[model samples]
Target: MSLTWRISLKSDEAEGPEDYFSSSLGIIFPDDITNQHGDAEHSLIYTSPHLSKSLLIDLADPVKEDDRKLFSHYLWNASLLLAEFVESDSLGVPLDNPRAAQESLSFDVKGLDTLELGAGTALPSIMGGLLGARRVVVTDYPAEPVLKTLRTNVVRNLQPAISPAGSSTTPADSVLVEGHSWGELEDSFSTTHRHSFDRIIVADCLWMPWQHANLHRSIAFFLREAADARCWVVAGFHTGREKMRSFYDADALREVGLEIEHVWERDCNGVERPWDTEREDDVTERKRWLVVAALKWIQIP
Candidate 1:
């Protein structure tokens, strides 16, 4: 027997202005099924009016099958979520060129040496590579299966070449995948790429209040030396207002010398709101909003 699931984009009837909204389609198997091998056996198909693509990811259980299963599940969920965001076209306004919310935040990516922290599935980093960035490094935690999956996605999605300005000149070559953790930022920076990236991009990385200090410290340590460095942290707040308050009060960002310059909201289409009055207590059904914060280093000139 096969199961089919649909993630609806329309939260309510009042439609907003965008042709398509981004969403992810997730597939899960019954827990009793122990023969599960990897993500490659499962097929994920993504379709939009403008873009349609299907990818098959393999799951290799080198040591523990259970670990592989858990990792695969997370990747599948993450990919679907990212797909929804990209398809919805509500990620953010294009700062430089017409690109996805993650890509657009990089301000054209042209000639910029960039790094994407906690880049699950590496969409923004891939976009940076597509946009002719001088060098694009996609980093996540040092988890084995996660890193493997990240590398696989990078190779699967890499374009033949990047045409800067859509010109016919030599195509730009950028490295795609790497590993770094907020906890290991100091060592990672000292060993590899050492004080390099001009722009650091982070999306949906501030969900957990506990990660604030380490994340801010990593950003500060790694990005402290760029001549004109900027860290763009984009967070989509679906958790709740209390978590947001906690995150703010942590002052992790202040300890690292970064300040939020502006806060704004973007109206997105295809978002769905459940009408389940009975499940009001369910945190998942609570109303959610998208929040963007533009951060820059405190200049003392």
Candidate 2:
């Protein structure tokens, strides 16, 4: 049977302004193997116009398999956005680019201790390592399948210099894959890595409202207690604005001693705008917008 159904990424008519989905950072999806059968995984190459190199990722067929395991196996749009943000060299607004407002923040991963919480395919962490971060630790739920795939992707993408835990012979080696379950401060990872990272990357990990407090705990734990340190988060509104909003609530963040330095909603076309709380329920429309934010640990007297 031939596939003829149309897959539309947006609605017939957007209630507000025109859709900005097309203004995405150059994330080119080049191939998908049709000859493969069963549950075999396929490779995806993610490239950006700003990046000198492309990322090779192996996502499980259909991606739903990872969904079953807490969405820890598939490549998400938020991940791509986070990666784009990390890869961007936009120091300040440029008059030459029309989408200049899209990149309102600068997040250079170079020479920094980076950590990614719930890194499924670990795209952002891999990008950080490739872009010359001082150290990049890719972590996820301590599950065998999840950790295995994460390690494979890290090695495949950041090969030659990639070092496994306890095997590093030099400082030149960057990427490290590990198992980390959020809020498990009693665990070895939590104890040893506390106040360890300069930057923490979280993409599309806010869908689970119940895990918000625990997620904050992890962020407060690993994030360095410095003024310049940041936890860069990019979460899609596809899961609904309320669910995403709960995670970034100011009071809630204050409870964990983490404060939002900057937060905004960005359209697919690279336009940065304020969040709209009164918007109607439209998952597709919501998907067209991403909440990008930077949070820092609040110093207490």
Best candidate (score: TM-score) = 2
Global lDDT of each candidate: 0.48, 0.66
- lDDT of model 2 at position 184: 84
Which residue window of length 10 is worst by lDDT in model 2?
A: 1-10
The C-alpha stretches of model 2 lying farther than 4 A from their native spots are 1-40, 49-53, 60-67, 90-104, 160-173
Candidate 1 per-residue lDDT, tens place, 101-120, comes to 33333344556777877775
TM-score of 2: 0.76
Q: How far is candidate 2 from the true structure (C-alpha RMSD, Å)?
A: 9.5
Error of 1 at 281 (Å): 11
**TM-scores for every predicted model:** 0.61, 0.76
